[model samples]
Target: MATIRCCTCGSPKENGKDKKNRIEMRKKTKGKTPRRISLRASLRASVRDLLHMKSKPAFVNVSFKTDSSRHRFIQEEIAKYGKGNITSRIFTYSELCEATKNFALQNLIGEGGFGRVYKGYIHDLHQVVAVKQLDRNGFQGNREFLVEVLMLSLLHHPNLVNLVGYCAEGQQRLLVYEYMANGSLEDHLLDLPPQKTALDWTIRMKIAEGAARGLEYLHETANPPVIYRDFKASNILLDENFQPKLSDFGLAKLGPTGDQTHVLTRVMGTYGYCAPEYAATGHLTVKSDVYSFGVVLLEIITGRRVLDMTRLSEEQNLIRWAQPLFRDKSRFHLMADPKLEGKYPTKALYQALAVAAMFLPICL
Candidate 1:
């Protein structure tokens, strides 16, 4: 028989090795303790799991944070993205639906290649806005929506349309923008009947200059630079004062970051307004905008759509028909819209025509 010694009591044991092994086992058992977790680590893990489960595509409509830390975080993030003062608001889909009456056809202002735009009043802001509901069915719509959000969120210019806020609820994607009272330049230029008050030369010139400055700002002022992919008359909106603001940034792209002079992209623009080089090779440069601007200037000068299928066979395409008339100042009168009727400054018109002519060959 073995007499055991308790390790703690230091009692004698006949089987010393067995007693020692028993003591060691007891010590090992005593050393074992329950694992503990940090509150923050546990919380983070839980949040990650929740986010994984809610994997649907959505936009974060961030509520304006009153907390100093949260506010500072937002400010820092906006600064990192090189954006100016942006008033943050998180509008619920229910609230917006109520405001626009569930995006009824009655609320719709216009429809374009991108999506349908609706007019809505944001009660908090106390202003009306144009809500562009992106079509989720098309890949192009999603691509354009992302591009617009990325570019517009960081951009702020007087001549550029203001992006008030955006919505991303499940498959629903919408962009809120400042509403233009007068609609697009194309609307006034082409859609209005002959009896309506046509755009005067002064207003037209101002529109041209304003549009140019907007494009120039995108090219020269914007960080990393941007090229307005679609620079047609329809994209130019007029305020109550008839001041032009460049809207519809869906096709906008960042300029080349490297030594490359141009960005190579798939051809994406209205048929007749796209630069000839870009249309042919998908190589887009700042000059592409200049080419489009020239086309618009031609339209303004001639009061002709870039492509008018209704016109005579010889004069159906504006650029092709008008390019030859550019050299003959005598033909400048022929190109001028009958509505102007010698109302514009001859020298100013002539100079503008000369500039448009110069761009034509390059664009062609």
Candidate 2:
């Protein structure tokens, strides 16, 4: 065979045989050599492209000057119903049944005019949540459920109870909410004995403020404005931190539009908390909520039920007893809960009382 030189070493070797062997070796080496890809270089290229690309325009431009304006802007944004936003979810009755152990009585938390609330865990979020399962016999049917879903999907505030999601399967309708560890304000204020001392004056003030913020958000902020028909202590839930959150939307309605003073509707609400004008004339307005808030404020102050027939002869009805006290600053001290042991600041308490008292005339 003819002589040949090695490609690397350049050494003279056998002719045809060595040349053939070297070529084969070269092919094998090329096959074994790994191709290098620089991830850093590719990333740099991607960043450059992103920096050069033109950004898409925003869906909407919003401007606001006052708290009311900010609220209106948020409401308008929510009404847009942008794509990829999850409004609500549908879950099979079997899934919910499994979650609540077939709606067992032991899992029940509380029962309301609308339906029963139960404690449940969602595997997807790995979090504990309260599930309100609407009873088929409830006065509010699918219409109320849909209204609640739409309102909750658009409304979001720290003091307002959040609507995590909803489920509609067959005859079953369910609403999921973040679990309130401390339960409702009514449970601590009215159900629990005075000896419990769980809700002190400070906590009561904080709760009142938080609940007010929630109402203000709904009234001044929500798009088209919303009137919470059922605004009572039982519907205000307390979290582990004692922060109050407004809930229960089965009786809620959209507030009045245009320059009309009030929207006339069928009278619906708890006895003691309903506004006088709403009860008598079936006309509702934002002032109706203010009236209910005043009643809640009274409950926080005097440690009394709105309508307690079992009390002492003169103090049977709390509103009637407190109305006169509200007018005379000299009797303001008597309006506070005696269990407070005179710990609350008189000035702040009086201010809150004044705010609540102003609602009486407006509501009437």
Query: RMSD to native for every prediction?
Result: 26.6, 26.3
Model 2, 1-364: lDDT tens per residue?
0111111122243589876898898678753543322112232222223223222111112234664544334323333332224455545667677777888999899996678999987788787888999886886555466456655655678888888877765456788888999889988887467568757777888888788888877775554457888889999999999989998876776666557677677788899999988999998888888888878888887778888888897898788888777667888999887777888877777766776666655221
Query: For residues 247-266, what per-residue lDDT tens digits would candidate 1 score against the true structure?
Result: 88777766654466777777
Q: Relative to the unseen true structure, what is the C-alpha lDDT of residue 181 in candidate 1, on a scale of 0 to 100?
A: 95
Error of 1 at 92 (Å): 2.5
Best by TM-score: 1
Computed on alpha carbons, the lDDT of every model, listed in order, comes to 0.69, 0.69
Per-candidate count of clashing residue pairs (backbone under 3 Å): 1, 2
Model 2, CA-based lDDT:
0.69
TM-score of 2: 0.73
Worst 10 residues of 2 by lDDT: 1-10
**lDDT score of model 1?**
0.69
